[model samples]
Target: MQKEEFIAIASKVSEGLATDQQKQLFLYHLGTFAKENPEWEKLDLGFRQQIEDEIKSDIRIQVFGEAKWKPKTTRLWPRIVAIAAAVAFIILGVYFFNYRNDKHLDIDNLVMQGVGPGKNGATLTLADGKKILLSDAVKGQLANEAGVSISKTEDGQVVYKVVGVRANEAGKNNTMTTARGEQWVLELPDGTRVWLNSASSLTYPAFFAKTGSRKVELTGEAYFAVAKDKLHQFIVKTKGQDVEVLGTHFNINAYPEEESVKTTLFEGRVKVSPFYTQGEALSEGEKATVLKPGEQSVLANNTIKVLPANTEQALAWKNGYFMFENENIKSIMREVSRWYDVDVIYQGNVEQKTIEGTVSKFKNVSTVLEMLESTKVVKFKINGKQIVVMPGKDNN
Candidate 1:
């Protein structure tokens, strides 16, 4: 197309005033011209100059219309001209996609916008076989269990420390359990650390014996940061699968309700497999899903899929947040009930809707439920510790 014709069509497109036929012709010609002149094909000088002058005139008109008075002095004109030049440069930069790359997206802002605190209430089982209500406990040391000192930190973290244990017997078994709406942090004798999620328990030794590998069994989800012990590996067992690691940070989701146990490796290497099968080793940024025997990992159709671990999303609970991305109502409620020590009852077909957002667990349960209700997809009514979710009439 001629330069004048191309400029006219481009300007129309830029102003969102192009007709349907004009748009189609403009797109076709633009594609053909781009393909033919792959180099830095310059616009016709006359055409470019005309557009530039038009842009300047448009700016001047806008400023004159908005200003209290017309430009009178040459000095003010220079300032206005400079401002227009800056704006024009910015417009050109955006038009050319100069700053559209991932690097310029401000990832920190994105993360902050999406992160929310996790639910913080849980039931605790004392060593004496007594169940203690922990959701409202003071943020400090709560008790001593089986010679292990248990304390609630100021930040609401349940911490465990072994007392009066000989260094030689450090690998002897000790246990810590938390019920729904609770979480705990345990520091292993070997300097490894574990953050247990609600309804999760961990069994480990008070001290490291240095004779065998450091091993622990988990019943629910947990985030682990293993201290490097090249001589001795660290092992975690959950249900039928086992994870072996030398030293690394990773998250394991082995909820009984979940169809598959997922082991997401954030750093270093981990070997994951069922107790009976010969499993393979996975490196950093990989996830191993332990499917039932005879079942294979099918990316296309498998309901139980292993996904690349977004550390912030996977470990948000441990970091005090509830994060969801396009999660179904059923899954979201399951998490809510576990952390709030409540029971979820679906009065109708509530799982048909999907939600995507983040909310603070520190907020009142009703507030969180109300926010979900604002989506107009579902309605929830709270009765004591049970929540009934029903499909809203207007949801569809």
Candidate 2:
């Protein structure tokens, strides 16, 4: 594009007079300009800084619905900085919305109304069947079980403290459960911290056994940072396998609806063994896989497969976002279903399409649906708490 055309489009955008197509064109040209110029320093320094300011302003306006772009003229930025900013703007645009042929795309169609995202909440079930709603329970001692004090912290965490608990009194069990659209953090008697994802549960003793392993049973998903204990190992038992660790950080996803059980280790060593009875050895032909940092093990059909892991993607729920890397549409919607507490219905035979991006899970369900729709590969329509998924216009 010529300099005059670029200047005109930028002016229209800054003045809030540019159409959607014009805005898309401006960004397309800016990305192309950055790619075409290898030695960006050769450009006029003042113009480069101007381009940087305009790109930042335009992106902020688009994302936040601001009125117009207000260019900053205080100081000049390096030429390389402007080029990098242009590239970043293009990437953000592609991730959030498809600018190409999106002039008539209706992003607001899916979100007739807003369905809020998940938050920190769960229920604590004592061994005797007493249920304490953590969200309503005041931030103090919720119960005293087996001589151990159970308290809800100011930050909404359930902590177990041994006051005068003898070893024999420590075996009483407690369970923490998070319903749909809820999540929670828990501190065990052994100082192991567990972050429970939505629609998940963890069952553990009020206090660890002073002699044997520190054992816990998990369902759904959770991230654990096990406290180091040389004499006593920590064990997490799931449906498909048991993970044994001395001290490590790991995430387990064993939701019954999923095709396989996945265990991702982020730190230290973890041994993933086939599930066995409490006192039973491994079955005749069962085997185990030892995972290193940055490795993941998948268990399905009584078989275990180990491979390199994407730690960030595996722990994205705990980190407050959904990170997808070539993840299929159905798989993505399943996550949306859990965090948003919504049911998904397919309108047609949706193609097996994949998406690659990151979106904040804390946003309203519509915002996430909008991002997916922006890819022009899938579409969604919200009715009450139900989300109807269909192929996008481009796919159609």
TM-score of each: 0.57, 0.72
Please report how far candidate 1 places residue 391 from its true position, in Å.
1.2
For residue 41, model 1's alpha carbon misses the true position, in angstroms, by 57
* Local lDDT at 194 for model 2: 93
Tens digits of per-residue lDDT for model 1 on 1-396?
774575466556544465655644544454344334322122222223443453356433533444343343533333333222222221121111111121221111111122222444555555355655556788777776556666776655556666755454443465677777767665665668787788888877655654677888888889898999998888898866677888887888778786567677667777664543247454322344543322222222122344455544575465444667777778888888777777889876776767765554544566567556656567766666677888754344
Query: What is the TM-score (0 to 1) of candidate 1?
Result: 0.57
Top candidate (lDDT) = 2
Question: Candidate 1 local accuracy as lDDT?
Answer: 0.57
Candidate 2 stretches greater than 4 Å from native: 1-108, 112-114, 168-170, 276-286, 394-396
Tens digits of lDDT, candidate 2, 223-319 = 9989999999999999878999999999999988898999999999999998645775554336788999989998987778899997767866775
Superposed on all Cα atoms, the candidates' RMSDs to the truth, in angstroms, are 19.3, 12.7
Scored by lDDT, model 2 comes in at: 0.75
